[model samples]
Target: MEAAMSTPGRGLTWSLRGRGPADVPVVADPGPWPPDSGGPAATGRGVRVCVVDSGVERDHPAVGRVDGSWVVVKDPDTGETSVRPTETGDSCGHGTACAGIVRRTAPECELHSVRVLGERFSGTGDVLLAGLRWAVEQGFDLVNLSLSTTRDRFARELHELADQAYFARTVIVASAHNTPVESFPWRFASVISVGSHQEDDPGLHLYNPSPPVEFFAPGQNVPVPWLGGATIRTTGNSFATPYITGLCARLLSAHPSMTAFQLKNALYLSAANVRFRSLPSLPAGEASDESSESDEPGELHRSRESPEPPEPRLAAGADGTGN
Candidate 1:
C-alpha cells in the first residue's frame, strides 16, 4: 500500500511510500477526482464542452447526442465570414474524434460543435478566430482546440483571443504540434497546452517545465472514432488535446464556481510524476486570487545544481487532414 502525507509549511508537500518516485516529498495531486476513480464524475451534469474543430458528427455512436452546432462560413466573393447555426455533422471526422473523447471522459456534459476546418482540414486564421471568439462569448465552460495556425501574422490576434477566453473563465485546452514548427494559441500561456505521451491509460498525464507544451497525455497510436461511424488508430497532438479537454470538463463540473486560474492549479497539482524543481512557490494568501499566475513558472521552489535549458520545439497544424 502507498502512503501519502502533506507538510503545512511554505507550500503543500507530499511523501509517498512505495516504488513510485522514491520517498522524496512531492506536490499533492489536486485533481477533482480521487486517485482511485472507478467511475465517471457525476458532477458533469450541466457543464458544456465545446469542440472548435472540423465540425463533429453529433449522431455518431461515439459522439452520442450534441446540444448545438455552428459552422464558420466564408463569402467566397468578398472573403467575409460569419458563424451560422448548422446541422450537427463532421467534415472529415477529426472534430468527431475529439468530441467522442470528451464524451467518453465526461458523458453527462452537454456537447457543442463549432466547425472551423473544412474537408481538407485547412482554413484561414480569420475563420478559426471567429469560431473561438464566438465560443468564448457564449460562455462555454470548456473549449477544445485540437488545431492551431503556423502563421506568425495571426499571433497578436490569437494572443488577444486567448487572453479573452482566460479572463472570461472559459478554459481553452489546446494541443502542441507533433513536428518542429511554430504555431499560435497553443503556445500562449493563457491556454492549457497538451502534448502526446506514450501511455496506454487515458487518465495518465504529466507536467513539463518546458514552455509552449505544458502537459502530456496519451496520444500514440491510440484508437479514436473517425468518419462515417468508423474507428481508426491515429497519432498526433490533435487526439491528445481532447483527453485534457474531457478532464477539464470533469473538473469544472465538480467545481462549478472555479475560475480558469483555479482549474489550472488543480491540473498542475494533480499531474502525474510532477517535478517541483522548476515550479515556483505560491506566496501566502495568494493561492485563492488572480495573482496566483505566478505559481506557474514563477520563482524556483528549491535550490538547483544546474537547470537544463528548455529545448525549442516546432508547432504543427492539427487540421486532421493527415499528410
Candidate 2:
C-alpha cells in the first residue's frame, strides 16, 4: 500500500516505496466465470459507476441501461457535439470497449457515461478534470478513468482531486498506462492502477508487467460490442481497467462501508497469481480462494510499500484515443 504525503505546490506528494518488481503469478485462464465465482448477481446490483471516457453506445446489448450521461466536449470549429450517437460515439471504439467490460462485470450497476474526450478521442486536461469533478458531485461510488495524458500539471491536479474523492470514500480506478513511458493520473497513487492479462491466450503474457498493476484483468483481443450493431475484438490496458472498476462496484455494493483504500487492498489480495514463463525471476503469490470474503471491509490490511511505478505500456493505435 502506498501513501501520499504533502508536497509544496505539488498538491499532494506521493512517495512510493516497498513495491518491488511485479511479483504476482499468472494463473490458468479461469474460463470466463470461475466456478462458483459469484457472477454480477453477487455484487453491484444498485451501485452507480461513472465512466469518464469518450461516450458509450447506450443501446449496446451489453449496456442494458444508463442512469445518466452528458457530452463534455464539442468541436470548437464545427460547434457540433463530439460525443457519439449524436455527432459523437466511439469512433476509435476504445470507450465502447471499456463500457462493455464494466457492464459485463457489473451488470446491475447504474452507469453514468460522461464524454470528456471527443469523437476523435482527444481532449485537454481541463475537460477530464471537469468530468471527474462532475462525477464526484453526482456521488458516484466508482470512477473509471480509461484515458490519461502526459501533462504533468494536469496530472497533479487530477491526483489531488482523486485523493480528495478517495478520502470521501469514492473509489477511483485507472488503467495502468500502456505506454513505454509513464502517463499521468494513472501514475497517481490515489487511483487503483489496473494492468492487462490474457484469459484465453495464456501464451500471451501480461502487458506493462509492473508492481503498479494492483490487479490483472482480461485484455488481449477480448470481445466487445462495437458501433453499428457489430462486435469486434480489441486489446489494451484501457479495457482491463474496467474489469477492476466493475469488480470494485461489486465489492462496494457488497460492503457499503468499505473505503477506497480497503477496496483496493481487497483486489490485490484477491487476484489469482500465476508465474509467467517470460518473467521467471518473479515469485508467485497466493491467489484469493472462494472461502475468503473479499466483500468485507478491513478483510485485508494495507502494505507499507511505496506506490508502484506508473504503468509502462502506452495506449495502442491512436496517441490520444480515450484509453
Candidate 3:
C-alpha cells in the first residue's frame, strides 16, 4: 500500500520568499509574564494541541509537557496492538521536527501525542482516519497533521473532519506536502495549509510561492530532537505547518472569544510582504509589475476589474478587522 503512494520530497518552494538561516525564533525570552513590549508571547498557555503523526518523545527538552497520548498501529498477523513506546514511534523524524516548531511558538500549549505513523513513516488510510476520530473525541483546541497520502477519498474524509473541528472550535493545521506536484488534504480548502519559507530572504518574504498558503514559517535547516539517540537538522513544509498551528493556539488563547474565521483573517493581514525586484521569472511576454503603491493605514484600495467581498460586520467577540 505504501508503494502506491508518492514519496515526500524536500525543499518545496513556498509562496512567500525569504532568504536566511533556518533557525525558528522561540517565544520564551524575558520573563514569565507577558512583556509590555510588542513581541511573540506565550499565548497558548492554556490550550491543548493534539499532534497526529508519529509518536513524540515525552522527555525531549523542547517538549515541556505531555497531557495525553495514544498509539494506533496494529499488528499484521493477529490484528493486535503493534504500537508500543519501544516499537512503533517516530523513527522518520518528520513528526518530531514539526512538533518542535509548534512548541517553539506556543510553549505553554500542552501536547497530545497521537501516533498514527509507525517505524517506517507509512500507514494505511484507516490508521489516519482512526487517529483523527480519536483527536476529535478528545476535544483538542488544535490538531497538527504533518503526514500526507494521495488517496482522494481519504482526503475528503479528512476535510469533513476539519469542518467538524472548526465548528467545534478546534483548529486543524496540516503540511502542504513537499512534492514535485501538489498533494491532497493540504490542497483541500478546509484545512489550514502551511508552506515552508527560508527565513531572512528578502525577496520571497511578502508574497506567496504557492496557493492556499495561509501563512509562512521557518522550515529550512531547523534543528529538532529525533527518535533514538540523536538530533538532526531538517527542512520542508511539513516542519512549517506546526509553527502556524502553535501560533493559532497563542492567538486563540489571547482572544478566546474569536471564531476560527476571524483567527484565519488576522494571520493573513499580519503577514509582511517583502518587495520583490521582479515578478518571479514568468513565461515569455507576461507583463507584471514589481512595485506596489504604498497606502496609508486604514486606506482601502480596489481594482476596477471586479468587486471585492463585502466587509464582515464586526461582532461583539470578533477581533479588529483588516485589509
Candidate 4:
C-alpha cells in the first residue's frame, strides 16, 4: 500500500525544496556517548522491537523470523478493543516490508508484530490509540508506529500515550505522513519522527534540523518484503521508519541503560549529515541581520556556537498542557 493515501491535507510539503549541501552549516563536534558500538554479534540480542502497523507475515522469507505476534480485535456493537495472540500474516504486505527492513538492520533483535491497520491500509483512531496504549504498557524497548491519526479529536489522547511511552522508556519511532497533512503521534516530540529521503542505501539516514520531522531515511524505490513470500521494490516513509528502528535495536542492545532521549542524541551525533568541524562565521553585525531576514528560503539560522539545533519541544502531554 502507498504510504501517501489520498486523505485531506495530504498535499503539504514533504521535501526540502531548493536546498543543497552548502546550505547546511557546519558545527563543532560533540563527543559521542551511548556509542553505536555493536555489530551483528550484538544485533539486539536482548532488545525487543514491536512493529505497530498492519501486520507482519511471520513466515515470509524476508520476515522469516519474528519472536511473537498480536492482533487487535474491536467489537463493533460495543466499541470495545481487545488484543489476542495470533500467528497472522500481513494484511497488505506493508507491515511485512517494515518487519523485513527491521530484521535486515538488526538481525538478532526480537521482533513482535501488532495489527492495527487492515487490508486497505486504514484503521480508526480509536483502534490505533488502543494498540499504542497496549504497546506502551507492555514496555517494549522500541515501538514502531508507521501509521498516524489525522483526526483532531484523538490528538490529546495520542499525545498522552506518546508521553507515557516516553517516560516509560519505550522509544516510539513514528513515520511522518507521506504528504504534508497534519498527523498525530509522529508530530509529538516525545516520539522520534521519521520521513523518507531519496536515497538507496538502507543504512544511510539524515537528521532534520527542521521541526515535525527529526530524521530521514531511505524510503524511495527500496526493495521490501511482500505478502506470499515474495519481494517487491516500493517506496514510502513507512519503509524508512524500520531502518531507524533497526538501528535503535542495535544501539539499545549495546547500551541497555540508554534512555529514549539519549538514544535520540546518539542518532543525531552519528547521522551522516552531522558536521564535526565548525564552519566559518560571518561578522557579528552580519549574523544579526541574517537572522532577521534570510535571502535563502528554509535556511536554518542558528548561532554557530552551539553544536546542534535544539530539539522540538514536546507537545502538550495527556492533560493538554505542555510538559
The TM-score obtained by model 2 is 0.65
What's the distance in Å from true for residue 112, model 4? 0.4
Ten consecutive residues with minimal summed lDDT in candidate 1?
312-321
Model 3, global lDDT:
0.62
lDDT for 311 (candidate 1): 15
Rank candidates, lDDT, best first.
4, 1, 2, 3
Residues 1-323, model 4: lDDT tens digits: 12334553554445656887676665532322222432223366688999988889878877767888898888877988898887777888888999999888877788998888772333569888888888888999999888888999999989878887887889999999999899888999999999999976666778999878999989999899898889999988998898888878876665566678877876786666765532336667654443444434554444333333232121101011110
Provide the TM-score for each candidate, comma-separated.
Answer: 0.72, 0.65, 0.66, 0.74
Weakest ten-residue segment in model 2 by summed lDDT: 314-323
Best by lDDT: 4
The count of residue-pair clashes in candidate 2 stands at 15
User: Candidate 3: lDDT of 217?
Assistant: 65
TM-score of 3: 0.66
Model 2 CA deviation exceeding 4 Å by range: 1-41, 74-91, 119-123, 199-210, 274-323
Across 1-323, the per-residue lDDT of candidate 2 in tens digits comes to 13343334454424435554464443421112222455323347778898888777767787767667676655567644333323345555667777888887776788878878654445457777777777776678899988877767787678778887878767788887786676767777778887787587421223233565566677878888777757898888888888778777766554455677666655543444421112122236866454445435444434323222111111110111111
lDDT against the true structure, per candidate, is: 0.74, 0.64, 0.62, 0.76
Candidate 3, residues 166-228: lDDT per residue as tens digits? 777777787777775645566665677777788843112122545675667667876777766
Quality of model 2 by C-alpha lDDT? 0.64
Better of 2 and 4 by TM-score: 4
Worst ten in a row by lDDT for model 3: 314-323
